[model samples]
Target: MKSPQALGLALIAALALSACQDKAAAPEDIRPVRYIVAGGQAEIGGDSYAGEIRARNETQLAFRVAGKVAAKLVNNGERVKKGQPLARLDPSDYQLDLAAKQAQLAAAESDLAQQQLNLKRYRELLAKQFISQAQVDAQQNGVNAAQAKLKQARAALDASRNQTGYATLAADADGVVSQVQAEPGLVVAAGQPVAKLSQDGPREVAIQVPENALDAVRRAGGFRVTLWKGGAPLEGKLRELSADADPATRTYPARIALSGDSRSLQLGMTAAVALPARASGELKLPLTAILDLQGKHYVWTVDDKTLRVSRKPVEVASIDSDGASIASGARAGDKIVTAGVHLLREGQRVKLLGQ
Candidate 1:
């Protein structure tokens, strides 16, 4: 047998040899992705905004009278039509108040009748010389006062009945209930928001865009907005751009008007607005094709007919519905690497997938 020191050196040498073999087994070149250079007229030159699909009319539904919510008939996200009852409040208190008003009105009418009778008696006494004319006038004045009170009481009863109607919440316009704030048996104050309704109207794409994008949007150019839903893209027109940036976000809100079946679109749907009008000679590619190495965005470029691939840093101009519009650092005649970019390093050799 060998000495103890020699045996230890042999074991270390064997491990080193195995590591070298494993390294040799790995591929030297990274396979690059092939791209088709189809030179067609691209219509992506517009102010692309990153926005969401939002309802045009969003109204807050509320109760007119202060009462406990007795029954909430509609659930959140339910569709409601005009004049439809969405919620009911406890009307017991209002009912009792109306009844009291009715009783008061009745009492006022009875008093008016008694005053009329008294006035008639006074008139007869004055005519028979048993009472003075002034006494008759005073009784007639009392009758007049009672009549006025009865009229006022009647109006009060009518007003109380109107208040009772407030216990039932009605939808003033057609819309979808975006949010339900009132719950069954919850007491809410008058004019308090019970639900948020998104009215049925033209949809808009609201996006928070950077301040630099504001100038481009105001230049009055044809912009395109795309809604990605269920793998099918819905196109829209960039209708309005904000005049100023939001104070809190430091970004401008760009709105896009959606067309055709806006009813199917709901609020807060993720959307992409492509603003590639400012981009000149930039290639539009999928966001997945981008890579980040040391905080820099890169993409893999493949060599034709060879298994080797190269990594290149691309300047992303803007990202919208289609993908990222590359402004610089990539060209139409270039081959990009897509697979395994995160694991790739500079000067790494890769093989094309089908080569």
Candidate 2:
């Protein structure tokens, strides 16, 4: 019933609407990219490692003789001077042993005295022909044996007395008790640790270095420390480094001595250590960002304003464990694409992540 012109016009309008809808439904062509700004010179900084403040000397205080602990005189964190009593063992047994030894020594001395008088009388009797020379000699021998026994007994007594003295635990140096392993009423063996002492001396920072960074750490020029509570950057120097790696952590233990204004440093306080990393001549880049096409290496660099990437051919230098060194074509501060090198074409638009 409608006219032919009206029908054609309606068809045209419907086709135009469909074209506009299809255009609106098209997806965005921008590629998501991750990039890093290259560094021209390899300067190591901003690497902070968690460490602990420690004294220069840490000693394990142990008893020299085995006994049941009687009383703990000083507890953990107690400060003590040299020869200070830390704990006491039950001295009842030691005292009893000492008394027995003393009694034995006294009896031996009495026997020795009696033998000497008898030997003297035997010599006089021999001179008067009342006893044979053999008899006199035998009496002299008896006296010598008694004297030997007395000496042995005296030595035993001294040993027993020393054992009695060992019942009291004493600090060997001025220090602060860091750990207490034995308490009153606990039986401990000889040379078993009863407490740990942090000796009064220089302070240092202890840190663990991973195997990959071990060489760099050893070659570090110096170190700096910052306390966890926040303070000025204090100077530090490497004092000790382990020759072998730890079995469990595979890390090497290193000690850095605190140099300036370290009076406020406390033991066991958490700290951060920054060691200067040795710089190499060439610049470093992520190994994944490097693409090898027909033996020629290339890296995709991004333009800041256009957000577009262009493949730049680069000469390969020595490759490192973490990244490859750029010999030529790329310099520091240049923005380079780190991901999806093969999928990206030259001059393609990209949307930076988190931008």
Candidate 3:
């Protein structure tokens, strides 16, 4: 019903409107990610490690002689002194036996005197040829037997005294009573833990490390300690490293002695042991550089003048307050993605954030 020119114009307008609607209907595309490139010149400080306080000398105090635990003078945590009587044993029997031994010793002494007098008489009689030589020899034998008996009695008395003395628990050194296993009237076996004496001294922080880290620790040179009580971070050295690995965990125990005893340092206080890692040679990137893809560790880096992320196998050397210290799998001048890496994949295009 319209003219040819009008129809042509309407057709062109409808085509243009259709093109506009098509463009509007299209979904919005995601924007490229931007990342910051950082240099690896920083010192990869020590990473945090869980640690505990331990006593270098934890002694288990025990009784030498087996007896009924008669008196418990001090309970756990009770202060004791050297040669201080912690408990007493039932000494009535030992005392009686000791007295009997003394009596026996006295009898032996009397018999020895009599034998000596008899020997003297025999010798004088033999000299005058009034008695046989065999008689004098018999008197001499009696004197020797009496002397042996006296020795035996003395030994028995000494043993009784030792057994009686062992009943009391004495402090070997000045320490706080950590534990008390024996109670009053409780029969305890010999050499059993009657008490635990915790020696007094400045406390230290201890930590357990994996065997793989032994070499890393040595190369790292020194370590730093950050007390969990929020005290000032202190520098310390690696005091010890167990040569043998723990069978249960296959980890080695590393003890770090704090430089100075801080007031907040308490026995059994938890701490974090961080070692300076960046100073030691390693690929150190920002914290955001680490990326995990399907159970594998990697980082996004620039390559070929394009932001292309690739799988980089990195051995975590240490974790510091600044960033992580990578043992390997990266080198200097590698541009690592600092943000938006979670949604990234191998060979994915990336634009530096805030660039």
Residue-pair clashes, model 1? 17
Clash tally, candidates in order:
17, 1, 10
TM-score of each: 0.60, 0.81, 0.73
Off by over 4 Å in 1: 1-47, 209-212, 219-222, 230-254, 259-261, 275-355
C-alpha displacement of 93 in model 2, angstroms?
1.0
**Cα lDDT of all candidates, in order?**
0.75, 0.86, 0.73
Better of 1 and 2 by TM-score: 2
lDDT tens readout by residue for model 1, 20-123: 99999986554344333311224234544567778877788889999899998898889899989999999999999999999999999999999999998898
Off by over 4 Å in 2: 1-37, 40-43, 46-48, 261-263, 287-297, 302-308, 315-322, 338-344, 348-355
By TM-score, how accurate is candidate 1? 0.60
lDDT of 2: 0.86
Instruction: Give all candidate RMSDs, comma-separated.
Output: 10.5, 4.9, 5.5
The residue-by-residue lDDT of candidate 2 on 211-305, one tens digit each, is 77776677777887888888788888889999988899888998999886564678889998987643644467878889889999999988989
User: What's the distance in Å from true for residue 89, model 2?
Assistant: 1.2
Residue pairs clashing in model 3 are 34-351, 34-352, 34-353, 35-352, 35-353, 43-278, 44-277, 44-278, 46-274, 46-275
Candidate that would win on TM-score: 2
Better of 2 and 3 by lDDT: 2
Candidates 1 and 3: which is better by TM-score? 3
Worst window of 10 by summed lDDT in candidate 2: 40-49
